[model samples]
Target: MWGLVAAGLFALTGYLAGSAVGHLGLMGHPLALRTTHCWTTGPSTTSRGGSTGGDWDCTGLAASGGRTHRITATGFTSYPVSMPVRVAQEPWGSWVPVDQGGWNKAGRALSPLVPLALAVTFARWTLISYRGWRNSRRLPTGSSE
Candidate 1:
């Protein structure tokens, strides 16, 4: 039971770490020219089941203003094909400015703490588990001799 709990905790930490790293990667970047790409939606599935319907995937690849010289982002959306999108530039590509408003902004504010939380959780678990192992090793074994 404890092992299963530990496994779940580790998985959670991994997810948090990935999110923190992704957010940090886009820090201090500029927004992209929105009008350069086309936008559309298609059939999508939710995580609960393979049953499709509840989701509409906005799939579109946008190009840079010939600066980076390639398509930078997918799954972006905008009002008109002629208008620029509200996207932030990342090192590898562009990202929708979802973090700029509402609940997403709250999530963005909390993201930087994930790595620290993960590190602390991992260290505490490691030390506790290691001490338990060491104590078990030092215990006397039962035998009839």
Candidate 2:
């Protein structure tokens, strides 16, 4: 029974440690911008000067640019969120962006299983302990019956 209890505790500790390490690894990365764009609007039809060209309607133009741009007009524009990015590590290792919310969601999904495992382990140990106690109580005081 004691051995069972010890093994159960060991397994629980290992799981907790692994979870901590996983979270730490997930957080160790730098945020980065993955994409950008440049839009222009004018009467000139020439697509030169780094401008891609007007769309089918000839009313606007769009070009792939970066957050670092030199705007020369006053018009409605938008910058959408960049694509997900990650930092590269050594020759064979790489660092990927961590989705903390996703990790938390996964943890929540596993929470129920954790308790169930612990309960089963503890119940097994408890049953063994109880059985041993019952057998001891049935033995004669000092006669070894």
Candidate 3:
């Protein structure tokens, strides 16, 4: 009941926060890689009080023209280390050149999930809350029995 509502709210907050930070370039600009190797850290949790959730992060070693650079990516699921990746320049700076194509591709590949997940959460919570409310209304308000 309240837990579902809180979960939905928290999901919405994360969606908004990630979108805002991603746009502001705090996460970094996307860099296309010809070759790379990624090592994913196990999903980690952030808990305060009763809420619990986690995200996966991967560190990639990308080689471009004989130079290798380290890149980090945060995602809901772990990426295949063998797959080529697009990483962004940190808000401060980066060793890799920022690629507009990579940035656009990253946005296209990743942005859809955020809205979809949030929508699903909203729908679930709405349905559960509605059902609970309707059921409560159908119940005897007073001990007429």
Candidate 4:
């Protein structure tokens, strides 16, 4: 049951992420602009208690009007890491003023999807944890004597 739940959740997350990617691309949004890329950085290790070893960072960049704006998300500590995004837009030329509004709007719109994905992931993990607890309670506490 746990496995099934996990698989279902994984599928759902994938679908959501993919949908966001596709939508941003087609909508000519921040995620669709030229030079958009996401990079994650952190040590890859897990503790015995299921805790992560280091901080994780997710950074995305998009360029418009001869300038680049960076959107970054970060996570740390245990599960369900919170990744608040930050945007830094560089001023280049006269085109910068005209493009700023659209870029800012796009960035703001795309921002919520991050938390949505995280919420879905957390729900899935919660389901798995609940199933484990249920199963453990059903099992006998001691060997037959």
Q: What lDDT would candidate 4 get against the real structure? A: 0.44
Candidate 2: tens digits of C-alpha lDDT, residues 38-116: 3435444455646443421111122224333222212212222334322222222322222246766477346546645
In candidate 3, how many clashes are counted? 2
Scored by Cα lDDT, where does model 3 land?
Answer: 0.53
Worst 10 residues of 1 by lDDT: 53-62
At residue 101, what lDDT does model 1 achieve? 47
Each candidate structure's TM-score, on Cα atoms with residue i matched to residue i, is 0.50, 0.30, 0.30, 0.29
Q: How accurate is candidate 1 locally (lDDT)?
A: 0.49
Poorest 10 consecutive residues by lDDT, candidate 4: 90-99
Deviation (Å) of 65 in candidate 3: 5.8
lDDT of each: 0.49, 0.43, 0.53, 0.44
Which ranges in model 1 have alpha carbons more than 4 Å from their true place? 1-28, 45-70, 77-82, 91-94, 111-123, 140-145
> In candidate 3, which residue pairs get closer than 3 Å at backbone N, Cα or C atoms, i.e. clash?
29-88, 29-89
**lDDT-sorted candidate list, best first:** 3, 1, 4, 2
* Colliding residue pairs in candidate 2: none
Model 3 residue 13 distance off true place after TM-score fit, in angstroms: 13
Question: Mind giving the per-residue lDDT tens digits that candidate 1 earns over 16-135?
Answer: 544433443344544444444344455466787675433212334445555543334444333434344444544434444433446665675576466556556666777789888888
Taking all chains together, the TM-score of candidate 2 against the true structure is 0.30
